[model samples]
Target: MVGVMDDNRLYAIGEVARRTGLSVSAIRFYSDEGVVPPVEVTAGGHRLYDVHAIARLEFVSTLRELDAGLEDIRRLLAGGLTLTELATAHLSRLDDQVRRIRSRQAVLRTIARQHTEAEQVVLLHKLAGMSDEDRDRLMDDFWSEISEGLQVSPDFLGLMRNGPLVLPDEPSAEQLEAWIELADLLRNADFRREVREALRETFSGPGAAMMTSSKMVAAFERGGVIMGRAQEAQRAGTPADSPLGREIADAYTAYLGEIAETPDSPAFREKLAADVLDIERLHLESLEEYKTSTDPYTRYQSLVAIIDGSARQAAEFMPFAWLSAALKASVSP
Candidate 1:
């Protein structure tokens, strides 16, 4: 409590409250907490504040509003911590709080939408609680296992072995779901073995294993141009049997020749067309298995891309879809 005061520089607690717009009790609590002690005390035991003390009260109010614990504030006032350190600590705390809240929201939405089983509900909560470092480490280990001892271009492997997945601070339900799916995929031996075997077969061509990294990159870039044309033709609804389609097919045949170290001839074209159909059949089989839905791997990468704001270039197998059509047309009657 504070009564009338006569000093021009010193103010009663009431005036300090009026000047700072803080409640009388709040200032008292701050004083009692030793965060902002009054400059003087009256004979009647009232607290008195000079301008400097009032300024400190205002600063204390701001810190309290930011959820700074009293001990931290006291240490800050005692010169044990700098303002920059305090702000940085609080900022990191806020980031963690926001992440947790957003994770809870995502978990709730996923559970409600999916009617997730108790077993999975437990797992989802565990995943939501994981720090970014733990999540990244888990992803790193999975990719390491997938690419281990593979006879493929390191550059090619690097593309699929995407770097850290930085889930946005405020993750969406979809992103969480994708993360969970990725975690599950990593745990599934069948998925791991299949992905490895596919990579093995794709890179097992006679000349593919023999090409230097630079040659592999050069071949990949040249193929990119052909796939770009394939995408354009596909987008324009060009008939597969059109001359334009055959031209694109011929270009792809040459690109394959470069990779296979085989000369472009009808025999090679026939072999290429047969090889293309084999891949096309595999894709068709996948579509049948999933009823034309996005494959789990593709869906996971796409969702992760949205979260991290990084582009996940469409998988190589995807562009090859258009090329498969052209190859079929080139070989048909």
Candidate 2:
């Protein structure tokens, strides 16, 4: 309608029909449905399109392929549904569909292994879901049983209990899988007993009380960073035995000394040294069962050597060597 009369570029309904394969009546119905608006009408009152209608028809065809209802398509075209908001909603629905499909695939995979139908069904159920509360309770029970027999101060036990595996109420498939694995781990009596034994030793030692816990944590944090640097310097050929390690050891010992009521007592430092070494030895021996003769680097063995050989030398010499000293300080007037 806005075109120059002499210009022959304007398309009539028949041309649009040929171009888009949509009947004139169908196009008219779409315009009425608000799927697309006409460009204009001619003076003779005939409907005219200026190349835009073909594009609109193609868009409508694609929407129809996607099973979008006509009214929904109309709202989309009318700007009632924003592209971002609409795409996000569809994507969330698609994700759920994908999760269900993957769960079925896992069941099929297990069935391929000649599992019984009941077993397959159980596996699917295990894979499919978990509630947040179930995850929390699983961790709570594990940590509680581990800490129950330990004389570990109340604060340390509380801290361990708080590190629960938090899962969403509507978790993704990956999260569900992790939850199942974690729950299975919690059910293992060997693992539970291992944790209990470890906590018992750590709690029975000199740093069992709240203040000692705080100081040890601070020392570990401070010492760990220094330990990393010291090892790096030694690895760089700085010294056969870098004083960096010794310095950190000294700093850790000095920190314990400052807080220790018996900083100057040689007997206390020597006792603390023996205690630290004994704890490391116990940690190593307990894990020896899992180590292969061929693999010299078990986790516990490596950790003990690293801490014992390096900064832990001073760690062994912590000035606050006696729990009785710490207790007396706590009750002092």
Best by lDDT: 1
Q: lDDT of model 1 at residue 35?
A: 85
Instruction: Tell me the alpha-carbon RMSD of every candidate.
Output: 9.9, 12.5
Candidate 2 lDDT, tens digit per residue, 1-333? 332333335677767777777888887887777677667778997777766666778788777766556776767777898767666766676777776676555445544554546744674556345455775666677777776766655554554443445544344444444344345446678767765776566667663575436555565556456445544544454442234434444444554566565573555545545654565566456445433422222322333233224223433432222322322232212
lDDT value for model 2: 0.54
Q: Give one digit per residue, the lDDT tens place, for model 1 in 147-258.
A: 7887777776665656677776677665666676566666678777776666666677787765636567677779879878877777777876789989999999988887
User: What residue pairs are clashing in model 2?
Assistant: none
For each of the candidates, give the backbone clash count: 0, 0
What's the TM-score of each model vs. the native?
0.57, 0.45
Top candidate by TM-score: 1
